[model samples]
Target: MSPSLFTSLDVKSGGGTAVFSFLILLLLKMAFDTFGYKMGMNPWPGVFGWYCNPAYRLFDFLLGYTGFLVLEKTDLKVSSWKISVIQCVTLVFYFAACHLFDKQWVPAPFILLTLVLIFAFTLPGGIFNAIFGNRVLTHLGNISFELYIVHQVNINLMNHTLLKWTGNNHLLVFFMLLVISWLMAEFFSLNPIKRFVTKSIYKSKIFI
Candidate 1:
């Protein structure tokens, strides 16, 4: 995913290439999910099972690339209200699909999420600015990579150590984990630590 690679792929150019790529990746994901289910090899069943699949990871990366591609390539002049409405509607559909459907091999949720992300990346001025343009979100974005790495460990630690203290209140445990994770991410966001962590992550297979 370097600039040269993207240029070579010509993903930014208008054509059926991107669409075809997405379709092929989607089919691969479905195949992997079905195979994993049949073999009982997926430790995390349902939608979560797709996370560990190589095909799904490629789809995920392409989905994200599509977001940035849309942001850079599109010149839509729609109203902020319309964009916000689209964002909200897409999110509603995504959540509904996640809860109502068995996602063993379904791609509805991911498709909806892609719509949400595409709109989100192209957020215009006005209400969108007032909301997503805020400093809190900017700060969170800055430390997002750090959060991604530490948040899970923080959740596991809190579940083991703090859940009993909170009388097994999962909600409270979640907030505690969130606070600790954010603090850890913020601490690691310091320039020196951030650089080292980023270098290590890029060198390892853990980074997408």
Candidate 2:
């Protein structure tokens, strides 16, 4: 389903509905994983098989849609104190999950963070808004798609070619990846470079 069709149910006019739909989507995602596994269709855990599954991809797209819906599609009117409480509660739940499951609990952090961000959308004059509402983040957002596409390649290239420069420190390697990926994304976003690539691809008949 296209996100544009449902973009009207936004925070300003439909905050309750938006939150409810977001939760429902979360439940549906979990249900699909559970039933897909029971039916012998979902990928085995940690195998990366679900990445190729059409059903999983649909839910992924919906989640991404709703994620943006909560983040930027509407004008949120939540107070900073309430948002802070939500953040604290989410952190507590995340820590509890990690402790009980004896694992790193990846989804918990993302979901919890999303929840906090949904409410943090309109913290006027607040540090959270000030921190994220910046030119640097705007630049990153502009290149986010390119960054996603090229980040893995940059990581692999750095690991193979530039590890010596960092003395094999993974922390430094991580920074190197960030810088390289941002630079690569900026390069790809340049109009002349984008047109060149598009023309080359068209000449190769890739569009057909």
Model 1 Cα lDDT, one tens digit per residue, 1-208:
3224455446434675555555665566566556665555676564345454433554556654544544455676788788777667766776776777655545534654665565664567534566677799989977875676567555644576797898888898889889998999899999988678557764456554
lDDT of 1: 0.62
> On residues 16-87, what C-alpha lDDT tens digit does candidate 2 reach at each position?
665666678787766655555445464544323444333455455556556666555546466677765655
Stretch of 10 with least lDDT, candidate 2: 46-55
Q: lDDT score, residue 180, model 1?
A: 90
lDDT of 1 at 142: 76
- Taking all chains together, each candidate's TM-score versus the true structure is 0.64, 0.53
Query: What is the number of residue pairs that collide in model 2?
Result: 0
lDDT score at residue 150, model 1, on the 0-100 scale: 67
RMSD for all candidates, in order, please.
5.0, 6.6
lDDT against the true structure, each candidate: 0.62, 0.60
